[model samples]
Target: MAHLLEGNFGQGSGFNECLSEHVLLTRFGIGINDPKWISIRLSLFKSITLPGVVSQNTSKLGWFIFIDSSWPSEFISDILLATKDFEFIKIIKVNFYFEYYIISEKLIAKSIDFYGRCLVSKIDDDDGISLDCFDVLYDLRGDFFACVFSSGYEFLCQNRIFKPSNMPFLTMNTHFDMRSLDDLKYLRIGHHRVAEFIDKERRNLHVQDEGRFWVYSRHKYSDSRFSAVRKSIVDDKKSRVISSADYHHFSIDFSLLQEFRSQSALLNGVPNEKTWLRQADLNEEAEKIYRQLVSMKRVIDEVGADVIQ
Candidate 1:
Protein backbone atom coordinates (compact mmCIF):
# COMPACT_ATOMS: atom_id res chain seq x y z
CA MET A 1 0.00 0.00 0.00
CA ALA A 2 1.15 3.57 -0.76
CA HIS A 3 -0.06 4.68 2.70
CA LEU A 4 -1.99 7.90 1.88
CA LEU A 5 0.07 8.95 -1.13
CA GLU A 6 -1.44 9.95 -4.49
CA GLY A 7 -0.32 7.28 -6.95
CA ASN A 8 -1.13 6.53 -10.58
CA PHE A 9 -4.84 5.78 -10.66
CA GLY A 10 -4.99 4.59 -14.30
CA GLN A 11 -3.23 5.07 -17.66
CA GLY A 12 -5.22 8.20 -18.53
CA SER A 13 -6.51 8.98 -15.05
CA GLY A 14 -4.56 11.98 -13.69
CA PHE A 15 -3.77 11.30 -10.02
CA ASN A 16 0.02 11.05 -10.11
CA GLU A 17 0.72 14.40 -8.48
CA CYS A 18 1.40 14.52 -4.76
CA LEU A 19 -1.81 15.40 -2.94
CA SER A 20 -1.97 18.75 -1.21
CA GLU A 21 -2.23 18.65 2.59
CA HIS A 22 -5.76 20.05 2.32
CA VAL A 23 -6.85 17.29 -0.08
CA LEU A 24 -5.40 14.60 2.17
CA LEU A 25 -7.37 15.79 5.18
CA THR A 26 -10.59 16.02 3.17
CA ARG A 27 -10.16 12.68 1.37
CA PHE A 28 -9.14 10.64 4.42
CA GLY A 29 -11.67 12.29 6.82
CA ILE A 30 -9.04 12.58 9.58
CA GLY A 31 -5.71 14.30 9.41
CA ILE A 32 -2.55 12.18 9.68
CA ASN A 33 -1.99 13.69 13.15
CA ASP A 34 -5.43 12.63 14.40
CA PRO A 35 -5.03 10.40 17.45
CA LYS A 36 -8.26 8.49 16.88
CA TRP A 37 -7.39 7.41 13.35
CA ILE A 38 -3.88 6.41 14.34
CA SER A 39 -5.16 4.34 17.25
CA ILE A 40 -7.67 2.48 15.09
CA ARG A 41 -5.18 1.83 12.25
CA LEU A 42 -2.48 0.61 14.63
CA SER A 43 -4.96 -1.58 16.41
CA LEU A 44 -5.97 -3.32 13.20
CA PHE A 45 -2.34 -3.60 12.01
CA LYS A 46 -1.22 -5.30 15.20
CA SER A 47 -4.25 -7.39 16.11
CA ILE A 48 -5.41 -8.49 12.67
CA THR A 49 -2.71 -8.10 9.99
CA LEU A 50 0.55 -9.12 11.65
CA PRO A 51 -0.43 -12.39 13.30
CA GLY A 52 -1.36 -14.29 10.16
CA VAL A 53 1.61 -12.86 8.20
CA VAL A 54 4.04 -13.91 10.94
CA SER A 55 2.52 -17.38 10.98
CA GLN A 56 3.54 -18.11 7.39
CA ASN A 57 5.09 -21.59 7.10
CA THR A 58 7.84 -20.54 4.70
CA SER A 59 10.69 -18.08 5.21
CA LYS A 60 11.39 -17.63 1.48
CA LEU A 61 9.47 -14.37 1.17
CA GLY A 62 9.91 -10.66 1.90
CA TRP A 63 7.11 -8.37 3.12
CA PHE A 64 7.73 -4.74 2.28
CA ILE A 65 5.49 -2.00 3.71
CA PHE A 66 5.55 1.40 2.03
CA ILE A 67 4.64 4.13 4.48
CA ASP A 68 4.79 7.87 3.91
CA SER A 69 7.93 9.58 5.23
CA SER A 70 5.87 12.54 6.45
CA TRP A 71 3.89 10.45 8.94
CA PRO A 72 4.18 11.47 12.57
CA SER A 73 7.47 10.31 14.10
CA GLU A 74 5.74 8.73 17.09
CA PHE A 75 3.42 6.74 14.81
CA ILE A 76 6.39 5.48 12.77
CA SER A 77 8.13 4.46 15.97
CA ASP A 78 5.08 2.49 17.04
CA ILE A 79 5.01 0.63 13.72
CA LEU A 80 8.74 -0.13 13.90
CA LEU A 81 8.35 -1.45 17.46
CA ALA A 82 5.40 -3.64 16.47
CA THR A 83 7.31 -5.19 13.52
CA LYS A 84 10.69 -5.38 15.28
CA ASP A 85 10.52 -9.13 15.88
CA PHE A 86 9.96 -10.02 12.22
CA GLU A 87 13.11 -9.70 10.09
CA PHE A 88 11.33 -10.26 6.78
CA ILE A 89 8.81 -7.51 7.44
CA LYS A 90 10.56 -4.37 6.20
CA ILE A 91 9.17 -0.84 6.66
CA ILE A 92 10.23 1.34 3.73
CA LYS A 93 9.55 5.06 4.05
CA VAL A 94 8.87 6.84 0.76
CA ASN A 95 8.66 10.60 0.22
CA PHE A 96 6.02 10.20 -2.50
CA TYR A 97 3.55 7.54 -3.66
CA PHE A 98 5.31 6.82 -6.95
CA GLU A 99 8.71 6.40 -5.30
CA TYR A 100 7.74 2.94 -4.02
CA TYR A 101 7.46 1.61 -7.57
CA ILE A 102 10.91 2.93 -8.43
CA ILE A 103 12.45 1.39 -5.31
CA SER A 104 10.51 -1.88 -5.74
CA GLU A 105 11.86 -2.26 -9.27
CA LYS A 106 15.44 -2.14 -7.98
CA LEU A 107 14.55 -4.68 -5.28
CA ILE A 108 12.96 -7.00 -7.87
CA ALA A 109 15.96 -6.63 -10.18
CA LYS A 110 18.29 -7.66 -7.36
CA SER A 111 16.11 -10.69 -6.59
CA ILE A 112 16.04 -11.89 -10.19
CA ASP A 113 19.81 -11.42 -10.54
CA PHE A 114 20.39 -13.64 -7.50
CA TYR A 115 17.63 -16.27 -7.89
CA GLY A 116 16.94 -16.15 -11.67
CA ARG A 117 13.21 -15.74 -10.96
CA CYS A 118 10.94 -13.82 -8.57
CA LEU A 119 7.29 -13.62 -7.55
CA VAL A 120 5.78 -10.25 -6.65
CA SER A 121 2.83 -10.27 -4.28
CA LYS A 122 0.63 -7.66 -2.57
CA ILE A 123 -1.59 -7.39 0.53
CA ASP A 124 -3.32 -4.57 2.39
CA ASP A 125 -2.39 -3.25 5.82
CA ASP A 126 -5.69 -4.56 7.27
CA ASP A 127 -5.94 -7.86 5.36
CA GLY A 128 -4.24 -11.22 5.94
CA ILE A 129 -3.63 -14.63 4.40
CA SER A 130 -3.37 -18.27 5.39
CA LEU A 131 -0.22 -19.54 7.15
CA ASP A 132 0.65 -21.52 4.01
CA CYS A 133 0.09 -18.75 1.41
CA PHE A 134 3.80 -18.11 0.82
CA ASP A 135 4.52 -21.83 0.78
CA VAL A 136 1.88 -22.30 -1.91
CA LEU A 137 3.21 -19.36 -3.96
CA TYR A 138 6.83 -20.54 -3.86
CA ASP A 139 5.70 -24.04 -4.77
CA LEU A 140 3.85 -22.86 -7.87
CA ARG A 141 6.38 -20.25 -9.09
CA GLY A 142 6.98 -19.98 -12.84
CA ASP A 143 7.83 -17.54 -15.63
CA PHE A 144 5.48 -15.00 -17.28
CA PHE A 145 2.30 -15.94 -15.38
CA ALA A 146 -0.10 -14.83 -12.66
CA CYS A 147 -2.09 -16.54 -9.86
CA VAL A 148 -5.01 -15.53 -7.65
CA PHE A 149 -6.07 -17.36 -4.49
CA SER A 150 -9.85 -16.88 -4.83
CA SER A 151 -11.07 -18.49 -1.62
CA GLY A 152 -11.21 -16.37 1.53
CA TYR A 153 -13.31 -15.14 4.47
CA GLU A 154 -14.50 -11.53 4.62
CA PHE A 155 -14.94 -10.29 8.18
CA LEU A 156 -17.08 -7.41 9.36
CA CYS A 157 -15.44 -6.29 12.61
CA GLN A 158 -18.23 -4.24 14.19
CA ASN A 159 -20.82 -6.94 13.66
CA ARG A 160 -18.28 -9.72 14.32
CA ILE A 161 -19.44 -11.57 11.26
CA PHE A 162 -17.54 -13.91 8.88
CA LYS A 163 -18.78 -14.64 5.40
CA PRO A 164 -17.51 -17.16 2.88
CA SER A 165 -16.50 -15.17 -0.20
CA ASN A 166 -15.92 -16.80 -3.60
CA MET A 167 -14.77 -14.12 -5.98
CA PRO A 168 -12.66 -14.44 -9.12
CA PHE A 169 -8.99 -13.31 -8.83
CA LEU A 170 -8.81 -12.92 -5.04
CA THR A 171 -5.17 -12.93 -3.91
CA MET A 172 -3.11 -12.16 -0.82
CA ASN A 173 0.12 -11.74 -2.82
CA THR A 174 2.34 -13.27 -5.59
CA HIS A 175 -0.22 -12.41 -8.27
CA PHE A 176 2.61 -12.06 -10.81
CA ASP A 177 5.55 -14.31 -11.73
CA MET A 178 8.81 -12.66 -12.84
CA ARG A 179 11.42 -14.80 -14.59
CA SER A 180 13.75 -11.87 -15.18
CA LEU A 181 14.21 -8.19 -14.46
CA ASP A 182 12.42 -7.41 -17.72
CA ASP A 183 9.28 -8.78 -16.04
CA LEU A 184 9.00 -5.52 -14.09
CA LYS A 185 5.74 -4.79 -15.89
CA TYR A 186 4.00 -7.45 -13.80
CA LEU A 187 5.16 -5.87 -10.55
CA ARG A 188 4.26 -2.28 -11.39
CA ILE A 189 0.49 -2.67 -11.33
CA GLY A 190 -2.06 -3.16 -8.56
CA HIS A 191 -3.64 -6.58 -7.88
CA HIS A 192 -7.29 -5.87 -8.65
CA ARG A 193 -7.40 -5.57 -12.49
CA VAL A 194 -4.79 -7.93 -13.96
CA ALA A 195 -6.98 -8.94 -16.85
CA GLU A 196 -6.73 -5.45 -18.32
CA PHE A 197 -2.94 -5.73 -18.55
CA ILE A 198 -2.22 -9.45 -18.86
CA ASP A 199 -4.03 -11.58 -21.41
CA LYS A 200 -6.35 -14.43 -20.35
CA GLU A 201 -3.89 -17.10 -21.59
CA ARG A 202 -0.94 -15.93 -19.44
CA ARG A 203 -2.94 -15.42 -16.24
CA ASN A 204 -3.81 -18.28 -13.90
CA LEU A 205 -6.94 -17.89 -11.77
CA HIS A 206 -6.66 -20.35 -8.87
CA VAL A 207 -10.03 -21.02 -7.25
CA GLN A 208 -9.92 -23.08 -4.08
CA ASP A 209 -13.34 -22.73 -2.47
CA GLU A 210 -12.79 -25.82 -0.30
CA GLY A 211 -10.22 -23.91 1.79
CA ARG A 212 -10.04 -20.33 2.96
CA PHE A 213 -6.68 -18.83 1.99
CA TRP A 214 -7.19 -15.18 2.88
CA VAL A 215 -9.00 -12.80 5.25
CA TYR A 216 -10.46 -9.44 4.16
CA SER A 217 -11.68 -7.25 7.00
CA ARG A 218 -13.92 -4.19 7.05
CA HIS A 219 -13.83 -1.58 9.81
CA LYS A 220 -14.60 2.13 10.30
CA TYR A 221 -11.15 3.27 9.17
CA SER A 222 -11.02 1.16 6.03
CA ASP A 223 -10.80 3.08 2.70
CA SER A 224 -13.86 1.22 1.51
CA ARG A 225 -15.71 1.53 4.80
CA PHE A 226 -18.46 3.55 3.11
CA SER A 227 -18.64 1.59 -0.15
CA ALA A 228 -22.01 0.01 -0.80
CA VAL A 229 -20.45 -2.19 -3.50
CA ARG A 230 -18.17 -3.74 -0.88
CA LYS A 231 -21.11 -4.04 1.52
CA SER A 232 -23.21 -6.02 -0.96
CA ILE A 233 -20.40 -8.55 -1.43
CA VAL A 234 -19.54 -9.40 2.20
CA ASP A 235 -22.68 -8.50 4.17
CA ASP A 236 -24.88 -11.25 2.77
CA LYS A 237 -27.46 -13.18 4.81
CA LYS A 238 -25.21 -16.25 4.49
CA SER A 239 -22.60 -14.61 6.69
CA ARG A 240 -22.29 -16.19 10.13
CA VAL A 241 -21.28 -14.93 13.53
CA ILE A 242 -17.57 -15.40 14.18
CA SER A 243 -16.61 -17.67 17.04
CA SER A 244 -13.50 -19.02 18.81
CA ALA A 245 -13.39 -22.06 16.52
CA ASP A 246 -13.28 -19.88 13.39
CA TYR A 247 -10.42 -17.86 14.89
CA HIS A 248 -8.16 -20.89 14.95
CA HIS A 249 -9.36 -21.93 11.49
CA PHE A 250 -8.41 -18.55 9.99
CA SER A 251 -5.03 -18.42 11.81
CA ILE A 252 -6.12 -15.26 13.65
CA ASP A 253 -5.18 -14.72 17.27
CA PHE A 254 -8.12 -15.29 19.59
CA SER A 255 -7.54 -11.97 21.37
CA LEU A 256 -7.90 -9.90 18.17
CA LEU A 257 -11.62 -9.23 18.69
CA GLN A 258 -11.07 -8.03 22.25
CA GLU A 259 -8.14 -5.86 21.21
CA PHE A 260 -10.17 -4.29 18.40
CA ARG A 261 -13.09 -3.76 20.78
CA SER A 262 -10.87 -1.99 23.29
CA GLN A 263 -9.39 0.18 20.56
CA SER A 264 -12.90 0.99 19.36
CA ALA A 265 -13.76 2.20 22.86
CA LEU A 266 -10.73 4.46 22.80
CA LEU A 267 -11.70 5.92 19.44
CA ASN A 268 -15.46 6.65 19.71
CA GLY A 269 -17.03 4.26 22.27
CA VAL A 270 -17.84 1.74 19.54
CA PRO A 271 -21.13 3.43 18.64
CA ASN A 272 -21.56 1.84 15.22
CA GLU A 273 -21.81 -1.68 16.61
CA LYS A 274 -24.50 -2.77 14.17
CA THR A 275 -23.02 -1.25 11.01
CA TRP A 276 -19.45 -0.47 9.94
CA LEU A 277 -20.75 1.72 7.15
CA ARG A 278 -21.44 5.27 8.37
CA GLN A 279 -23.89 7.11 6.17
CA ALA A 280 -23.68 10.86 5.69
CA ASP A 281 -23.74 13.28 2.74
CA LEU A 282 -20.23 14.60 3.40
CA ASN A 283 -18.93 11.06 4.05
CA GLU A 284 -20.49 9.92 0.79
CA GLU A 285 -18.83 12.75 -1.15
CA ALA A 286 -15.48 12.07 0.48
CA GLU A 287 -15.81 8.37 -0.27
CA LYS A 288 -16.70 9.17 -3.87
CA ILE A 289 -13.63 11.39 -4.38
CA TYR A 290 -11.47 8.84 -2.57
CA ARG A 291 -12.68 6.08 -4.88
CA GLN A 292 -12.04 8.29 -7.88
CA LEU A 293 -8.54 9.22 -6.72
CA VAL A 294 -7.30 5.74 -5.87
CA SER A 295 -7.97 3.59 -8.89
CA MET A 296 -6.10 0.70 -10.65
CA LYS A 297 -3.75 1.62 -13.51
CA ARG A 298 -0.66 0.29 -15.26
CA VAL A 299 2.39 2.10 -13.97
CA ILE A 300 5.15 0.88 -16.32
CA ASP A 301 5.80 -0.35 -19.84
CA GLU A 302 5.26 -4.02 -20.74
CA VAL A 303 8.41 -6.12 -21.03
CA GLY A 304 8.31 -9.36 -22.98
CA ALA A 305 9.15 -12.74 -21.41
CA ASP A 306 12.78 -13.76 -20.92
CA VAL A 307 14.48 -16.31 -23.17
CA ILE A 308 15.74 -19.54 -21.60
CA GLN A 309 19.55 -19.75 -21.44
Candidate 2:
Protein backbone atom coordinates (compact mmCIF):
# COMPACT_ATOMS: atom_id res chain seq x y z
CA MET A 1 0.00 0.00 0.00
CA ALA A 2 2.86 2.38 0.75
CA HIS A 3 4.29 1.58 -2.65
CA LEU A 4 1.20 2.87 -4.41
CA LEU A 5 2.13 6.39 -3.35
CA GLU A 6 5.75 5.87 -4.37
CA GLY A 7 7.27 7.70 -7.35
CA ASN A 8 4.60 10.35 -6.94
CA PHE A 9 6.57 13.35 -5.52
CA GLY A 10 9.53 15.25 -6.93
CA GLN A 11 13.11 13.99 -6.40
CA GLY A 12 16.22 15.78 -5.04
CA SER A 13 19.85 16.18 -6.08
CA GLY A 14 22.05 13.32 -4.81
CA PHE A 15 24.27 15.87 -3.07
CA ASN A 16 25.59 13.84 -0.19
CA GLU A 17 28.65 15.58 1.23
CA CYS A 18 30.13 14.45 4.54
CA LEU A 19 27.75 15.98 7.01
CA SER A 20 28.84 17.64 10.26
CA GLU A 21 25.42 17.42 11.84
CA HIS A 22 22.32 15.26 11.46
CA VAL A 23 19.20 17.34 12.10
CA LEU A 24 15.85 15.85 13.01
CA LEU A 25 13.21 18.28 11.72
CA THR A 26 9.94 17.16 13.21
CA ARG A 27 6.37 18.52 13.12
CA PHE A 28 4.51 18.15 16.39
CA GLY A 29 0.96 18.98 15.39
CA ILE A 30 1.77 22.28 13.74
CA GLY A 31 -1.38 23.98 12.37
CA ILE A 32 -3.58 21.35 13.99
CA ASN A 33 -6.11 23.30 16.04
CA ASP A 34 -8.12 20.22 16.88
CA PRO A 35 -8.14 19.71 20.65
CA LYS A 36 -8.35 15.92 20.47
CA TRP A 37 -5.23 15.70 18.34
CA ILE A 38 -3.38 18.10 20.62
CA SER A 39 -4.13 15.96 23.67
CA ILE A 40 -3.20 12.73 21.94
CA ARG A 41 0.00 14.29 20.63
CA LEU A 42 0.96 15.49 24.10
CA SER A 43 0.35 12.04 25.55
CA LEU A 44 2.39 10.32 22.85
CA PHE A 45 5.28 12.77 23.13
CA LYS A 46 5.48 12.44 26.93
CA SER A 47 5.65 8.67 26.53
CA ILE A 48 6.67 7.27 23.13
CA THR A 49 8.45 9.88 21.00
CA LEU A 50 10.72 12.30 22.86
CA PRO A 51 12.21 9.74 25.28
CA GLY A 52 13.66 7.67 22.43
CA VAL A 53 15.12 10.86 20.91
CA VAL A 54 16.81 12.01 24.13
CA SER A 55 18.23 8.49 24.62
CA GLN A 56 20.01 8.41 21.27
CA ASN A 57 23.37 6.65 21.34
CA THR A 58 24.86 9.01 18.76
CA SER A 59 24.95 12.63 19.89
CA LYS A 60 25.80 14.18 16.49
CA LEU A 61 22.30 15.43 15.91
CA GLY A 62 19.81 18.21 16.67
CA TRP A 63 16.05 17.89 17.09
CA PHE A 64 14.04 20.75 15.50
CA ILE A 65 10.40 20.62 16.60
CA PHE A 66 7.68 22.69 14.86
CA ILE A 67 4.42 23.84 16.38
CA ASP A 68 1.85 26.32 15.15
CA SER A 69 1.60 29.67 16.92
CA SER A 70 -2.19 29.61 16.69
CA TRP A 71 -2.32 26.70 19.09
CA PRO A 72 -3.72 27.50 22.51
CA SER A 73 -1.31 29.31 24.82
CA GLU A 74 -1.69 26.62 27.43
CA PHE A 75 -1.05 23.78 24.99
CA ILE A 76 2.07 25.37 23.58
CA SER A 77 3.16 26.35 27.06
CA ASP A 78 3.07 22.74 28.19
CA ILE A 79 5.23 21.74 25.24
CA LEU A 80 7.77 24.49 25.93
CA LEU A 81 7.95 23.43 29.57
CA ALA A 82 8.72 19.85 28.61
CA THR A 83 11.24 20.96 26.00
CA LYS A 84 13.05 22.99 28.64
CA ASP A 85 14.35 19.66 29.94
CA PHE A 86 15.93 18.88 26.54
CA GLU A 87 18.41 21.49 25.38
CA PHE A 88 18.83 20.11 21.86
CA ILE A 89 15.21 20.55 20.85
CA LYS A 90 14.51 23.88 19.11
CA ILE A 91 10.92 24.96 19.09
CA ILE A 92 9.52 26.91 16.12
CA LYS A 93 5.96 28.10 16.01
CA VAL A 94 4.59 28.55 12.49
CA ASN A 95 2.34 31.38 11.39
CA PHE A 96 -1.35 30.80 10.75
CA TYR A 97 -0.57 30.77 7.03
CA PHE A 98 2.29 28.25 7.16
CA GLU A 99 1.83 24.49 6.87
CA TYR A 100 4.21 21.57 7.45
CA TYR A 101 5.58 21.52 3.89
CA ILE A 102 6.72 25.12 3.74
CA ILE A 103 8.24 24.79 7.19
CA SER A 104 10.44 21.89 6.00
CA GLU A 105 11.50 23.48 2.74
CA LYS A 106 12.31 26.81 4.32
CA LEU A 107 14.46 25.15 6.97
CA ILE A 108 16.31 23.07 4.40
CA ALA A 109 17.06 26.08 2.21
CA LYS A 110 18.32 28.05 5.22
CA SER A 111 20.49 25.14 6.48
CA ILE A 112 22.35 24.55 3.20
CA ASP A 113 25.38 26.62 4.25
CA PHE A 114 25.05 26.31 8.03
CA TYR A 115 26.68 22.89 8.24
CA GLY A 116 29.45 21.09 6.32
CA ARG A 117 27.07 18.18 5.80
CA CYS A 118 23.38 18.25 6.74
CA LEU A 119 21.16 15.21 7.13
CA VAL A 120 17.53 16.09 7.76
CA SER A 121 14.78 13.69 8.79
CA LYS A 122 11.17 14.28 9.72
CA ILE A 123 9.74 12.32 12.66
CA ASP A 124 6.07 12.46 13.56
CA ASP A 125 5.05 13.85 16.94
CA ASP A 126 3.36 10.57 17.79
CA ASP A 127 5.98 8.15 16.40
CA GLY A 128 9.51 7.36 17.63
CA ILE A 129 12.89 6.87 16.02
CA SER A 130 15.26 4.16 17.20
CA LEU A 131 18.25 5.23 19.28
CA ASP A 132 20.60 4.09 16.52
CA CYS A 133 18.46 5.65 13.80
CA PHE A 134 20.81 8.60 13.36
CA ASP A 135 23.98 6.48 13.59
CA VAL A 136 22.70 4.11 10.89
CA LEU A 137 21.34 6.81 8.56
CA TYR A 138 24.42 8.98 8.93
CA ASP A 139 26.83 6.13 8.20
CA LEU A 140 24.85 4.97 5.16
CA ARG A 141 23.88 8.49 3.99
CA GLY A 142 26.51 8.57 1.22
CA ASP A 143 25.97 11.60 -1.15
CA PHE A 144 22.35 10.89 -1.91
CA PHE A 145 19.98 13.79 -1.34
CA ALA A 146 17.64 11.46 0.61
CA CYS A 147 17.17 7.97 2.03
CA VAL A 148 13.99 6.16 3.04
CA PHE A 149 14.38 3.54 5.77
CA SER A 150 12.06 0.67 4.83
CA SER A 151 11.79 -0.88 8.25
CA GLY A 152 10.40 -0.08 11.72
CA TYR A 153 8.00 -1.14 14.47
CA GLU A 154 4.27 -0.57 14.63
CA PHE A 155 3.17 0.44 18.10
CA LEU A 156 -0.52 -0.22 18.57
CA CYS A 157 -1.24 2.24 21.37
CA GLN A 158 -4.94 2.60 21.96
CA ASN A 159 -7.26 2.10 24.87
CA ARG A 160 -4.27 1.96 27.29
CA ILE A 161 -3.02 -1.24 25.66
CA PHE A 162 0.51 -1.44 24.29
CA LYS A 163 0.88 -3.89 21.42
CA PRO A 164 3.82 -4.17 19.04
CA SER A 165 3.35 -5.50 15.58
CA ASN A 166 5.33 -8.64 14.74
CA MET A 167 6.34 -7.42 11.34
CA PRO A 168 8.52 -4.94 9.45
CA PHE A 169 7.79 -2.20 6.82
CA LEU A 170 5.46 -0.57 9.27
CA THR A 171 7.52 2.63 9.70
CA MET A 172 10.43 4.21 7.85
CA ASN A 173 12.72 7.20 8.59
CA THR A 174 13.73 9.60 5.76
CA HIS A 175 16.38 12.21 6.44
CA PHE A 176 19.28 14.22 4.92
CA ASP A 177 17.72 17.42 3.51
CA MET A 178 14.63 15.51 4.60
CA ARG A 179 12.80 17.77 7.02
CA SER A 180 11.62 20.13 4.29
CA LEU A 181 10.33 17.18 2.34
CA ASP A 182 7.37 17.19 4.64
CA ASP A 183 6.24 20.08 2.44
CA LEU A 184 6.66 17.98 -0.66
CA LYS A 185 4.05 15.30 -1.14
CA TYR A 186 1.58 15.57 1.82
CA LEU A 187 -0.04 14.30 5.07
CA ARG A 188 1.53 12.94 8.30
CA ILE A 189 2.22 9.20 7.96
CA GLY A 190 2.84 9.08 4.21
CA HIS A 191 5.00 12.24 4.29
CA HIS A 192 8.08 10.10 4.98
CA ARG A 193 8.19 8.87 1.36
CA VAL A 194 9.61 12.19 0.20
CA ALA A 195 11.50 10.96 -2.86
CA GLU A 196 8.71 12.08 -5.16
CA PHE A 197 8.90 15.74 -4.18
CA ILE A 198 12.55 16.53 -4.87
CA ASP A 199 13.12 19.26 -7.45
CA LYS A 200 14.96 16.95 -9.84
CA GLU A 201 12.89 15.48 -12.62
CA ARG A 202 14.22 11.98 -12.14
CA ARG A 203 14.88 11.04 -8.52
CA ASN A 204 17.87 8.98 -7.42
CA LEU A 205 16.21 7.47 -4.36
CA HIS A 206 18.33 5.34 -2.02
CA VAL A 207 16.17 2.66 -0.55
CA GLN A 208 17.57 0.60 2.32
CA ASP A 209 15.82 -2.27 4.09
CA GLU A 210 17.04 -1.28 7.53
CA GLY A 211 14.66 -3.03 9.87
CA ARG A 212 13.58 -1.61 13.25
CA PHE A 213 14.98 1.81 12.45
CA TRP A 214 11.97 3.58 13.97
CA VAL A 215 8.57 2.93 15.49
CA TYR A 216 5.17 4.06 14.10
CA SER A 217 2.22 4.49 16.42
CA ARG A 218 -1.57 4.34 16.11
CA HIS A 219 -4.23 5.95 18.29
CA LYS A 220 -7.70 7.47 18.06
CA TYR A 221 -6.37 10.87 16.91
CA SER A 222 -3.78 9.77 14.33
CA ASP A 223 -3.86 12.32 11.49
CA SER A 224 -3.48 10.31 8.34
CA ARG A 225 -5.26 8.00 5.90
CA PHE A 226 -6.46 6.02 8.92
CA SER A 227 -7.50 9.01 10.99
CA ALA A 228 -8.72 7.97 14.45
CA VAL A 229 -9.41 4.46 13.15
CA ARG A 230 -7.22 1.35 12.95
CA LYS A 231 -6.27 0.77 9.32
CA SER A 232 -2.75 -0.67 9.11
CA ILE A 233 -3.25 -3.84 11.12
CA VAL A 234 -1.44 -6.36 8.94
CA ASP A 235 -2.25 -9.24 11.22
CA ASP A 236 -4.22 -9.38 14.43
CA LYS A 237 -2.93 -12.70 15.70
CA LYS A 238 0.70 -11.58 15.34
CA SER A 239 0.27 -8.73 17.84
CA ARG A 240 2.08 -9.17 21.18
CA VAL A 241 3.92 -7.29 23.92
CA ILE A 242 7.05 -5.35 22.96
CA SER A 243 10.21 -7.16 24.04
CA SER A 244 13.49 -5.81 25.41
CA ALA A 245 15.16 -6.51 22.09
CA ASP A 246 12.34 -4.92 20.16
CA TYR A 247 14.01 -1.51 19.54
CA HIS A 248 17.64 -0.93 18.56
CA HIS A 249 18.41 1.95 20.90
CA PHE A 250 16.48 1.20 24.10
CA SER A 251 13.52 -0.88 25.09
CA ILE A 252 10.34 1.12 25.70
CA ASP A 253 10.32 2.45 29.25
CA PHE A 254 6.77 1.51 30.18
CA SER A 255 7.15 3.41 33.43
CA LEU A 256 6.95 6.65 31.45
CA LEU A 257 3.85 5.59 29.55
CA GLN A 258 2.32 4.36 32.81
CA GLU A 259 2.66 7.79 34.37
CA PHE A 260 0.75 9.43 31.50
CA ARG A 261 -2.05 6.86 31.64
CA SER A 262 -2.24 6.95 35.42
CA GLN A 263 -2.62 10.73 35.42
CA SER A 264 -5.38 10.65 32.80
CA ALA A 265 -7.21 7.84 34.59
CA LEU A 266 -7.01 9.58 37.92
CA LEU A 267 -8.32 12.79 36.35
CA ASN A 268 -11.36 10.91 35.16
CA GLY A 269 -11.81 9.15 38.52
CA VAL A 270 -11.12 5.69 37.16
CA PRO A 271 -11.00 3.06 39.89
CA ASN A 272 -7.69 1.50 40.72
CA GLU A 273 -7.14 -2.08 39.77
CA LYS A 274 -7.69 -4.70 42.47
CA THR A 275 -5.19 -7.15 41.05
CA TRP A 276 -4.29 -5.97 37.59
CA LEU A 277 -5.94 -3.58 35.16
CA ARG A 278 -5.90 -6.31 32.54
CA GLN A 279 -8.33 -8.48 34.52
CA ALA A 280 -11.36 -9.05 32.29
CA ASP A 281 -13.57 -6.86 34.45
CA LEU A 282 -11.15 -3.98 34.95
CA ASN A 283 -9.55 -4.38 31.51
CA GLU A 284 -9.90 -1.28 29.32
CA GLU A 285 -11.33 0.80 32.15
CA ALA A 286 -8.29 3.04 32.41
CA GLU A 287 -7.93 2.96 28.67
CA LYS A 288 -11.37 4.50 28.43
CA ILE A 289 -10.39 7.33 30.75
CA TYR A 290 -7.27 8.01 28.76
CA ARG A 291 -9.21 7.98 25.52
CA GLN A 292 -11.90 10.06 27.16
CA LEU A 293 -9.36 12.75 27.96
CA VAL A 294 -8.38 12.92 24.35
CA SER A 295 -12.02 13.29 23.42
CA MET A 296 -12.84 15.87 26.08
CA LYS A 297 -9.76 17.93 25.34
CA ARG A 298 -10.82 18.22 21.72
CA VAL A 299 -12.05 21.71 22.55
CA ILE A 300 -9.61 22.41 25.32
CA ASP A 301 -9.06 26.04 24.38
CA GLU A 302 -12.69 26.83 25.06
CA VAL A 303 -13.30 24.42 27.97
CA GLY A 304 -10.49 25.56 30.27
CA ALA A 305 -8.82 23.30 32.90
CA ASP A 306 -11.46 23.87 35.58
CA VAL A 307 -13.01 20.43 34.94
CA ILE A 308 -9.87 18.59 35.97
CA GLN A 309 -9.07 21.14 38.68
Residue lDDT tens for model 2, 1-309: 001000101122211221235667666664456665576578778677877787775366556676666678788777777667665566666442233344444445445455534566666777887777666766776656666677665666644323443332233366544334333333343443344454344554666674556777765445334432344453455556666565335445576666655544433321233211123333246335545765777757567777656
Cand. 1 TM to true fold: 0.69
How much lDDT does each candidate structure score? Answer: 0.57, 0.54
Candidate 1 lDDT over 103-186, as tens digits, reads 566566666666676666766667767767666666655533666677777877666778877665643633666666666875
| Local lDDT at 294 for model 2 | 56
Q: Looking at model 1, how many pairs of residues clash?
A: 1
Best by TM-score: 1
What is the RMSD of candidate 2? Answer: 15.6
Model 1 poorest 10 in a row by lDDT: 20-29
